[model samples]
Target: MSIISLDSVCKSFGALKVADAITFEVREGEALGIIGPNGAGKSTLFNLITGNIAADSGTVHFLGEDVTRQSAMQRCLNGIGRSFQIPQPFGKMTVFENLLVAGSFGQGKSERAVEQAAADILDRTGLIGRANTVADSLSLLERKRLELARALATAPRLLLLDEIAGGLTEGECSQLVGTIKDIHATGTTIIWIEHVLHALTSVVERLLVLDFGKVIAVGEPAGIMARPQVREIYLGIEV
Candidate 1:
């Protein structure tokens, strides 16, 4: 069953077209990876789905309901939790406190009602050790983990991760990938936009490639990456 569907969704900023009639479906409990060069409108596609950007044309359906017109806050309350490409934590808040805020506000629950789940998310994301540390003081890897943890704290049925593994060292990226695999193992649907090809292919069941705001190809990871046009456009390689 599809947990989310986008049909003919189009978006633009003045004269610049960001998403050109983009359409796709993400299955329930499936992990999907999105890949493209910079300015392919990858993040814009995400914004549209999460209601951060409204489509100029077409529809967005979540869990079989039309949510094209829903606001970002409404989408979050409906279980669409996302992490930004840049970590956006409250600098003064401790790691655990960050999760608590996300859980309570994003899920519309009280702090006490979400505490246990928040703690579990910390443990799962490998942030338990840094739970007491202030968000601004965390290392890059820890900040990345906290970002993931905060999203998980909202109890997302569908999680949208934006470049979560982008700046990590090899070992740190591996650690985050392991946590993501664990999340996927528990049947949380994921749509990850990433530049880390190996890390992405490690977790996602399928891959989608975009260029110039259009989906050039999408299929099994190996097949998608092997496509000549995809290689040329996304990797800057000649066939």
Candidate 2:
């Protein structure tokens, strides 16, 4: 079953088309990875799906309903949650406080109503020890974990992660991937965009390649990476 579907979705900024009649589907409980060069419109795709940017044309359907016209918060409360490429936690809030805000507002519930769930998310994302610390003081890796935790707090059925592993050390990336794998184990559908090939490939069942705002390939990771065009365009290596 497809959790989300983009049917010929299109978006543009003035003369530049960021998403050009791009179509794809993410299956329920599946992990999909997206890769491309710096200007491939990877994050723009995320914005389209999350309703952060309205498409110029086409439709976005989530779990069988057309959500293209829905607001980002509306889509979020309807089981679509995401993390930005840059971690955007509330600087003055405590680590746990950040989750509470995400959980309460995201779920449209009272903060007290989501307390336990927020605490559980902290533990799962490996932030239990730092729960009381202020968000502004967290290390890069810790902030990334908090970002993931904030998304999880929304209790999304489909999670969109954008370059969450970009700045981490190898060991840090592995540890974060471990937590992400555990999240996937629980059957949450995920579409992740990452520049870290090894970490991205480790968790995603399939890969989607984009170029200049268009989908160029979508297949098993190994097969997609082995394509001559993908190699030359994405890896800058001619096979």
Candidate 3:
């Protein structure tokens, strides 16, 4: 069964329809990449799934349970986690401290649990040596790693990644892609929203193309890119 499912979902903000009768599914351990134009409503779709905003219509099912009305915190507790487009680590805190806070606050873990979880996540995200470094003192790449580590501290089954590779050097993007691949290899399902086509293509087996609040294509990475509509809407600008 699919780990996550959205059926005929619809959401509108005033006259703007951000998601219009959208439908898709993410299978267990599947890495699904989402691409779209700047205003294609990709982030809005993420918000609807995570309960940042209520959908006007349709149902959202996560791990086979209806979560259309679940609060964001509830979703997190229920195994939904996300990293934002912008990294928001606690500047004054060390990388370890930031992750500890996520485990304690977001997952309600005990002190020992938080510490252990944070340590494990830091190792998994390749930030072990820099665990004591102040978050704000890190470079942009390290900051992004901290974001992923913080989300990992929550112990999610399915992770929603919003433009995690938006702004990074080529090498940094490649490194992040490998880290994300490792995370998925450990059985965490990932849905990544990324403008960097090459990075997404390297990590994800399946792809979904969103445009103007609708799913224009869903298939293999190359197939989606080959679609005329998708190319005209997103890939054109990319090339």
Candidate 4:
């Protein structure tokens, strides 16, 4: 089943059109990669779907229902969990506490349920060993894991990953990709917006190329990278 769908969605900031008639669907258990130059509306599209920013026009649907009018919290509870481009964790909170908060607030589960959920999420995101570590004291990689762990605490069927691999070393990127692949193997659908083409190509089967706030190409990863238009936009940046 298609878990999420966007039809003729449009959003703008003053004169800049962020998402221009954007339309796409994410099937259950599929990982989709979105690539484009900086400011190509990738993050904005995620915001539209997650209700962080409302679209000026068109529809946002989830699990076959129109959720265009839903608020961010509503969307989170409705199986849409997103990790931001920048890690957003409470500096003073322990890694475990952050996930517990997400489980209780975002999922509306009981304290015991939240505790179990947080533990499971930490295990899945490879943060169990550092569960008691304060968020501000963690390294960049651990911080990223906590970001994903917090999202997983919501038990989302569809996960939106925004630049989670950016600013990481090649080895670090490989480890993160492996972790993400493991998560996808367990059946969570993923929509990843990343500038690291190699990391994205390694994990995603299908690719969507956004340019100037529009989808220019959508196909198999290698085929999309080979497209002349995609090459032109990235200016020969190897994928």
Model 2: per-residue Cα lDDT at residue 34: 98
Residue-level lDDT tens digits of model 4 in 1-239: 89998999999899999999998888889999998888889999899989999999999889999999999999999989999888889899999999888888888888687897689778867789999988999988888888888888888889999999888888878888998998899899999998888898889989999988898988899888777878988747554
lDDT of 4 at 73: 92
lDDT of 3 by residue, 1-239 (tens): 79999999999999999999999999999999998888999989989988989999999999999999999999999999888777888999999999888898788778786798789889978899999999999987788888788888888899989887877888878888888998899999999999888999998999998988999989999888887888887876655
Q: What is the lDDT of candidate 3?
A: 0.89
lDDT of 1 by residue, 99-208 (tens): 99999999889999999999888887878888899999998767777878998988899999999998788998898899899999989999999998889999999999
**lDDT: worst 10-residue window of model 2:** 230-239
Q: Considering every candidate listed, which one attains the maximal TM-score?
A: 2
TM-scores for every candidate against the unseen true structure: 0.95, 0.96, 0.92, 0.94
After the best TM-score superposition of candidate 3, give how far the Cα of residue 144 lies from its true spot, in angstroms: 1.9
**Per-residue alpha-carbon lDDT of candidate 2 for residues 1-239, written as tens digits (9 for 90 to 100):** 89999999999899998899899999999999999999899999999999999999999999999999999989999999999888888999999999999999999999889999999999988899999999999998788888899999999999999999988888888988998999999999999999899999999999999999999999999999999999989998442
For candidate 2, give the lDDT. 0.93
Q: What lDDT does model 4 reach?
A: 0.88
Candidate 1 lDDT (Cα, 0 to 1): 0.91
Computed on alpha carbons, the lDDT of every model, listed in order, comes to: 0.91, 0.93, 0.89, 0.88
Measured by C-alpha RMSD in angstroms, how accurate is candidate 4? 1.5
As a whole number from 0 to 100, the lDDT of residue 134 in candidate 1 is: 93
Range of the 10 consecutive residues with the lowest summed lDDT in candidate 4:
230-239
Cα misplacement distance, residue 205 of candidate 4 (Å)? 1.6
- Model 3 clash pairs? none
